[model samples]
Target: MQSIRDRLEIILSRLANRADEKVYTKLYSEAARAAADAADARQKAGVGLGLLDGAIVSIKDLFDVAGEPTAAGSLMLASAAPASRDAAVVRRLRQAGAVILGKTNMTEFAFTAIGDNLHYGTPGNAVDASLIPGGSSSGAAVAVAEGSSAISIGSDTGGSVRIPASLNGVVGFKPTARRVPLAGAFPLSMTLDSIGPLARSVTECALADAVMAGEDSAFLQPIALAGLRVGIPRGVLFDETQAEVASAFEGSIRKLEQSGARVADLAVDDLIAEMRAATKRGTIASMEGAEVHEDWLAAGASVPVDPHVSGPLSRALAIPASVYIRTIRRRTELAASMDERLASVDVLALPTTPMVAPSIAAMTGDEALRDKTEGLLLRNTQAANQFDLCAISLPMPGMILPAGLMLVARRGHDRHLLGIAAAVETLLGR
Candidate 1:
């Protein structure tokens, strides 16, 4: 095997060759070199950290690295005070001996689904420059896809990690919201935000997740496909889905059935509708996000924030506290309903996004289209967050532009979901 230092150097060389300043907000060249060297020395001495030792990992910009201000993909926080300590997850990653590659770009405040960042140039889709990388985890996905980092950590509130992972053709795993501690990360929604890892394969994601969650990095044992029960929620999730994406999803289902997995329609439209109704004033994300940025929202135009992020957030300020409280209570009840509903099925499957990545130009040029596209992109994946479940998005087989086949399981069933994803990935020959 190549030495850790050797691998890190190659990645550093690649970063040096490209104008990747927008993709990676910072590059810990000297620090990474030192970490790599330490790992190599430990290997020579027959002592090493756990599974993630020597792994090249990149964290989302929202994570606080000691002594640096967490910008979170906006100019507003660029001048904020430096963090006194590393984010919780960052500290955990370092403890596992993972070499930090530095911070990747994200959507402003991690509020938007599409990956456009006017302050830091959007990191184009990994496969096609014209298309979006999908965000708010845009740079995390791009860094993994471009081989700059073996694993990129991202924050997923509503499909931030999965959307970018799908568009960029990689694996992204979002554990239950509370599984990994959230301290030191710039907040979008305290209730909804989850920190997850995006990587080239499900196993890699599992390893990173285990390390960050402070669990033992046990090797994932792929669940046998033959008796696995898979649920396909076939209602609103399919609406306005591009032909290619829909076709790919069907093909994956058929493949799974042929492999002896049982597939059946699971109606979740009503449950989702009720959840949406409860949050009609605004999503839990928007309401909580607005509260987090109340000072900035009050500053209005003086703040010079992304309007896409600030608009809905500002509107959410009008949402009465009674409504916010009601929405939270209703969401809790609905989440219980969803969990009970999911008990009959081993996992719920769907397209990570209703459609594949649209061109960055088209998304940026048309406001209405962008809004519509954002809804479509977040539709299928957001349910996992709202319902307090674990989910993984695996790149589908044989797509010119990438799409994802997402599998969601009950809350705290993260390990099971990763095992199932590994099984599906194997079946799909990924």
Candidate 2:
């Protein structure tokens, strides 16, 4: 392999001629060059950091990088006070000797799953520029998919990271919410926010996730596929799933079965319905997000912000405090129930997004269509956040348009889930 510095130069050259501002909020070219040079020097001296040393990485815009305001894909906070220090994850990434490429674009306040940023402009899907790149980790996935970065760190609050990764045809992992510290990250929903990684392979995601979670950066060993129980939650989540995505997901399951994995239908539709009922007032994420952005919402019309973000937040704010409290309490009970229900299976498999990437022009042109599309996109993946589970989206092979086969495991089983994903990735010949 070429030296880290040389590889970085090639990536920079490729990006130099592209209009990538929509994909990257800010590029750390000077900082990246310095870090790459250091990594190269360390290599020459026969000294180096672990797995992440000399690796190029991109961060979602919500993370604070000392001396810069975390705009988080919004113009409203473009002039916000600069951060006094790097975010916890950012500091950790540096300590691991990872080269910081840039801050990738995201939905304003990480609110929407559609991935279009009116302020920073939207980043087109990595496979097809005209399609919506699934968000709020839009640029993070695009950066990795476009090979501008070796890996990308992104926040997953209600499917942001996995959705984009699925649409972009890459690996995206959402660890259990508390696995990684959230300090210095712009909050969307404190309750649901999780930091994770996107990369070309499951191993890269695992390594980056371990570093961010403050765990040992050791290579992951694939768990045996034989006799591992894989559950298929076959209900509302599968509703309206596009034909191509459905076919691809089914094909993936067949491949796993052929590899000696045990596959069965785990009936969780009732539990899903109950969970939905518990949050009828609003989801835990939207309710908590409203609280985080109270001042912004209070500023109302004076603050120019995306209506898609503000509208849902405004509605969530109107929900009675008592209702929000009841929902939170009920959610805890539901999450526990989900954990118990999942004990029979090693993991649950589903389509990451019910549909493939849709044209950005179509989404932007029709308001009703946009809302409907966003709901469909978030349906399957949001369950992991709602129930507090570790989930990963692996690109399904042989699809005309990219889609993800999501595998969800119980909370705090991030490492186990990554191992399973690695084994499955190999089975898929990815």
lDDT of 2: 0.92
CA lDDT of every candidate: 0.91, 0.92
RMSD of each: 1.1, 1.1
Clashes per candidate (backbone, < 3 Å): 0, 0
Q: How accurate locally is residue 209 in candidate 1, as Cα lDDT from 0 to 100?
A: 93
TM-score to native of every candidate shown? 0.98, 0.98
Candidate 1 has which clashing residue pairs, if any? none
Q: After superposition, how far is residue 192 of candidate 2 from its true place, in Å?
A: 0.6
Off by over 4 Å in 2: none
CA lDDT of 399 in candidate 1?
Answer: 89
Candidate 2's clash total is: 0
Cand. 2 TM to true fold: 0.98
